[model samples]
Target: MGIVELKNLTKSYKQNRGIMDVSFSIEEAEIFGFIGPNGAGKSTTIRTLLNFIYPTSGSATIFGKDIIQHSKEIRQNVGYLPSEVHYYDDMKVVDLLKYSARFHGNLNSTRMKDLAARLDLDINRKIEDLSFGNRKKVGIVQALLHEPKLIILDEPTSGLDPLIQNHFFELLAEERDKGATIFFSSHILSEVQKMCDRVAIIKEGKLVAVETIEHLTKNKVKNITITFEQPEQFTFTVDGILKREVNGKEVTLLYSGEIKALLQHLIDLPVQDVLIEEPTLEEIFMHYYE
Candidate 1:
């Protein structure tokens, strides 16, 4: 069985704005991305898997066990960072971290200290006085300190700066190297493409596509940029040409079809330069989203 599996898993809220009949599976040691725009039910699907909210229909399993039936037992081996961070204002960062460590039954001062220094967080400071970025660092430390088997992050980079974000991604890479399965949910398409092996595209509370990063980016799509010898007003009468644009002596096309046929068409034209490449994740996602 996959490490995490959802069979038509779904949830509905009173406002008619929740996930609908979503289904996907995550393999062990895989970094699976759940991506969409804001208010697209990315967080709702995550909440259901974590059992923070019950599902309206269908079912899901983590570590081969039902999420709701064995939530307490399952959570002990999982680490999570929510999109929003909140804590007791009066508590010191160290104190709060220690409290979370108590559940794991082991506290390594060296590990905690290293994590704080790496993220540029000050444990001596009170939670109330920390900035949003600093508070996010604390949440990161807490989530990773336990060395859980599964890591679930919902927009974990929201409050971090570029430098700190790089450090944080490095830490996640280390965790993956240590055999952790990651479920990363975000509306940021670039970051999801950077860290995930496969992605499931969700839009407006509905799942649209699930594909490997390699497949999504490299296969089934080609962006062609052509510069003709002189200005020409010609039409693209080929199959699978999704979009076409023209300038004085240049033409660009977003295409998906047999390359041989495309090359055959280009051979007879007065082409001076031509470049064809695979499109980026964002470029490809637009086809599905809009």
Candidate 2:
């Protein structure tokens, strides 16, 4: 069994909304990405795994223990950062973090201070006084304070700046290096592309695909742009060319299949420059949905 395993998991709500028959496994010490837009049952799946909400059917296990039966114990070694963060307005950040740490017998001030400094967070500030971004920082510190075995993050980079997001990713890498499994859920493709080894795509409460980053991007589709020195029109009659757009002197298209053959076809053209890139996750989504 993997570090986290879900078998035929289903969670149904009114109006026939929620995930259905979703099954996947996350390996130990690996970063697994869950991707979908809001209201796509990403959070529902997560909440069900953590036992915040019960699954309608099927079973999930964490660390070889059933999620429902061993929820309290399972959570002792798991850290979670939800998409939306809420905390007591009356308490200071430091106080709240300490309170949370006590649950895991980890009210270690030094670790908390170190994480706060690394994230440039002021723990002494009152929760109500902190901005949305700063509040998110507090959430980060709280989630990592105990150094849990599994880290589950939902849209963690929402309120963070680029630099801080970089730092956050680095921090996650460090945790992963220390043998922690990471279940990173995000709608943003770039973040998943940068961090996850494998990605699972979900849409409208159903899973569509689960694949390695290279398999999904490198093997599935590539974006190619050919430019000429002067205005020239070109036609590409390739079977796997899913999309083609022509602008004066430039032809851009989304292509799949053998790169060697595509290059062979382009070799005879008057190409001044060529740019080939892997399509983004959004493009991959469209590819799957369509």
RMSD, each candidate, Å? 1.4, 2.4
lDDT on C-alpha atoms for all candidate structures: 0.91, 0.91
Worst 10 contiguous positions by lDDT, candidate 2: 230-239
Per-residue CA lDDT of model 1 for 1-290, tens digit only, reads: 98899999889899868999898999988899999888999899999999999999999999999999999888998989999999999999999999999998888889999999999999999999999999999999999888889999998999899999999999999899989999988878889889999999999999999999999998888999989999987675789888888989999888888888888898989999999998988888887876
Candidate 1: misplaced stretches above 4 Å? none
Residue 241, candidate 2: Cα error in Å is 2.0
Off by over 4 Å in 2: 227-237, 263-275
> For candidate 2, lDDT tens digit of each residue in 47-120?
99999999999999999999999999999999999988999999999899989998998688998999999899
**Highest TM-score against the true fold, candidate:** 1
